[model samples]
Target: MDYSPHPTTAPSPPPATGSVSGKAVRPGDRIFLGLSRGSGIALLVIMAAIAAFLTYRSVLAISGDKSNFFTTLDWNAVGTEPKFGIAVLAFGTLVSSVVAMLIAVPVAVGIALFISHYAPRRLASPLGYVIDLLAAVPSIVYGLWGALFLVPHLSGLYGWLNDFLGWTGIFSYSNGAARSLFTVGILLAIMILPIVTSVSREVFLQVPRMHEEAALALGATRWEVIRMSVLPFGRSGVISASMLGLGRALGETMAVATVLSPSFLINASLLDPGGGTFAQNIASKFSEADTFGQDALIASGLVLFVITLLVNGAARLIIARRKEYSGASA
Candidate 1:
C-alpha cells in the first residue's frame, strides 16, 4: 500500500519571548515604577501639608474680628481688633500683572518669533542664551536696579505722560513721583520679560518644519508664515508663558515693594501712587509682624495661592484643548 505524502504543517512561531499583557514584569521595571509612584505620593503629601498649614493659619486670621474678608479695604493687622482685607492687594496684583502682560506678551512674542524664524542661526543662539541668563538673575538684584536706576529715570517720562495724556486719565500723574502702580508694572514687565520670551521662543521653534515649508512653498512671506503656521500652533504655549509671567508678577515682592509706595485706596489711573500687592504687603511686614499680623499675612498669601492655582488650572485646560486640536489635525 502506497501511503500518500503527508502535507507539511508549519510549526507555530515560538511564543513571543518577552512579557505579555498579563505577564510578570521584570524586577527592575517594577522597582522603578514603585519609586515613581512613591515619589508622586510624597509630592502630594507635601502639597497637602502646605495647604493644611496655610489654611490653619488663615482661619485664625479670618475668624478673628476682621470685617467681611472680601470687602474691607483696611490692612492694619496691629490693632486691638486687627482689621485687614485683600481687596487692595488683589487689585494691585491684577493691575500690575495685567500691565506686565500687556508690555511683555507682545514683546516676548516678537522676540520669540525673531529668534525662531527671522534671526540668523549664529546670532539667535547667543541672544537666546543671554535671555535665559537674564531669567536666572536674582529678584533682589532686579529690585535694586528698579529702585536705583529705573525709578529715577521714569520720573521724566511720568511728567511727559502727565503733560501730554492727562486728558486720557490713566496716564495722568498727581505729583511727578514715579513710585506708582505704573512704575511697579514697568518693573514687573522687565522682570517677567525674559521668562515669557524664553518659553515662547521654545514653543515657536517647535512648530513643525513641514508646516513652515508648506507655508513658504505657497509663497507666503516669512512674517505671514509665522503668523499663520507658528503663532497659531503656539497659541496655547503663549498663553501659558503669559500666565507664568503673570504668576511671577503677582508674587514679585522685593521689586514691587521697592518700587511701590502703597496706599490703601484704589484708583483708576495707573499713575496714582496707590495700592499694594499680597507679596509686597507680606514682604514689607513679615519681618516686623506679631502673631496676629503674621496670621493676617498668611491669610493674604492664601488669596494669592488661590489666584495662582486658578490661573495655572485655566492654562492647563487651554493647553489640553490645544493638544486635542493638534492630535485631531495630525
Candidate 2:
C-alpha cells in the first residue's frame, strides 16, 4: 500500500494575540457605539423640531404687527393690525436675572466652600443634604412665601435703599408696593441658591487631596490653600453652576408672576411695583388674552427661549475657552 493513499490534517494555530488583534472590535462595543450615535441624532432632531415650531408660531404673531416689535412699549395686540413689543419685558427679565446672579453666585460659592471645607466633618453630610432639599421645594410654594411674607418684610430695607441710593433711579422707591423688580430679583436669588450651592459643593468635594496637601506642605494657610489650590481648579465648575442658577432665574414663571406687578412700561425705578418679565407677563395675561394677544405672548416666549439659549451657549463657550476647564470637569 502506498503511504500517499491517506493524509492527516494539521491543527489550526490559536487566535493571534498581537497588537493588531487587540484592536479588534467586540460585538458589545459595536452595539453600544451605534446606540449612542442614534441617541445623539434623535436629540438633535427633537431640538430642531422645537425650534421650528416656536419660530413658526412667533412669525404668525409678528406678521401683522403695526408697531416695531423691538421698540414699542405697548403690548396691545387686540384688534386688526395688532401691535406689541418685548422691550419692557426683556429689560425687566434681564435686570432681575442679573440681580439674582449678583446676589446668588458669591453667596452660593461661600456657602459651598463652608459646607465642603469649613464645616465640621460630622456636620458636613447633614448640611449638604439639607441644602440639596432646598432645591426640591415647589416653585409655587416659593411664590406664596414671596407674596405673603417677603414682600411685606422688605419695606424697611427698600426704604433704606431709597434714602441712600434713590439718585441712581433704579433703586428709587416711590411709595408703591414692594412687588417690584428688586423684590423679584431677591426672591429668584433665594430660589436658585440651592442649585448653585449643591453643584459647587460637589465640585469642591472633588478637589484632589494631593493638591490640597501640596499647598499645605508649602506652608499655606487654610484660606490660602483654598484660594490657590481649590478655587483655581474648580473655577469652571462654579461658573457652570452659576449658569444653571441664572437659567433658573431667567425662566422662572410662577414665582415671578406671583411676586411681580407687571407693567408694559419700563420704569426707571426697580423698587417701583411696575415691571414686566417675559415669563411673568405670559402667566399673568394668558388667561385674559384674545387670539391676537395670545399670539403676541407666544412671540415674547420665543424671544425668551432665544435669550436662554444664547445665555447657555455663551456659558459653554466661556468654559470651553478655559484651558483647565476640561481637567477640572473631569
Candidate 3:
C-alpha cells in the first residue's frame, strides 16, 4: 500500500433534469405539483368570481336603496323606495357571536386540557369520540333541537339572569319568549364547543414531550408544566380554533332563524326577543324576496363575507406573529 492516497477524488453528482433541488424531478412529484398549483389557482378564481358577483348584485341593490345602507335598520327591500340596511343584522351577528365566543372558548379549552392531559387514556378516547359525533350532528338537527327543547327550557335561566344582571341592560329580560339573541348565543356555544375542543385537544397533544419532561425534571408540578410549556405552545392553535368557532357562529342560519324572533330593530337587551342576523335574514327573506330584494340580501351577505374574511385574516396575523413562540418554526 502506498503511504499517500492515490489521487482521491469525489464522485460527480447527478445533473438536474428539470425544476428540482439539484435532482431530476420524478413524474409523480411533477404531477402532484401541477395538481396542487391548479387547485390553488382554481380556488382563487372561484373566490374572485364570487366576489365579483356579489359586488355587482350589491351595487344593483344599493343604487336603488333609499335608506342609508349602513345606518338604517329598516329592511323593506321590495317596497316602492326599496329601503334596506344592515345595522340591526350587524349588531345581532356581532353580539351573538361575542356571547358564543365568551362562553365557548374557556369551556372548550378546559375540556381540551382535560382530555389531553388530565383524563386517563381509557376515558379520553371515548370522550373524544363523543365530541366528534357531536360535531357531525347536522345544523338542521341543532336548529330543531334549539327551537323545540332549548328555547323552552331556558326560560328559568333567563329569569335568573334578568333578576341578577338586569341592571346591565344587556342581560335584562322582559318576560318575552326565550327566543332571543342570548338564547341563540347559548345554542351556538353548544354547537361550536365540540369543534373548538377537538382542535385545542389536538394542539395540546402536540406539545413536545421533551419540554414537559424537562419541566418535570425541574420539579415542576403537572399544572405548572402545562401552564409554562403546554399553554405557550398551544396559544396560537387555541386562537385559530376560536376564530373557526366564531366564523360558524357568525354565519349560522337555520339554527339562528329557528331560535331568534327576527326583527329589523336593534334591541337594547340581548335577552329581548327581537333581533336578526345576516344569515338568518338571508335565509328567511331570500326565498320570498323579489329580484331587488334578493340583490339587497346579497349585499348584506357580502358584508358578512367581508367581516368573516377580516376576522380570519386577523387570526392568521396573530398566529403568524406567535408561530415562533409556539415552537412551530422550530
Best-performing candidate as measured by lDDT? 3
lDDT of predicted model 2 = 0.88
Q: How far in Å is the alpha carbon of 181 misplaced in model 3? A: 0.4
> Estimated TM-score per prediction?
0.87, 0.85, 0.87
lDDT of each: 0.86, 0.88, 0.90
Show where candidate 2 strays beyond 4 Å.
Answer: 1-42, 317-330
Instruction: For candidate 2, write residues 62-125 as lDDT tens digits.
Output: 9878989998998888876677888999899999999999999999999999999999999999
Candidate no. 3 TM-score: 0.87
Tens-place lDDT digits, model 1, residues 200-314: 9988877879999999999999888988899889989999888888878888899998888888888788987888899999998898889999999999998898888888788
Q: Can you write out model 3's per-residue Cα lDDT over 38-153, one digit (the tens) per residue?
A: 99999999999999999999999999999899999889988688888999999999999999999999999999999999999899989999999999999989999999999989
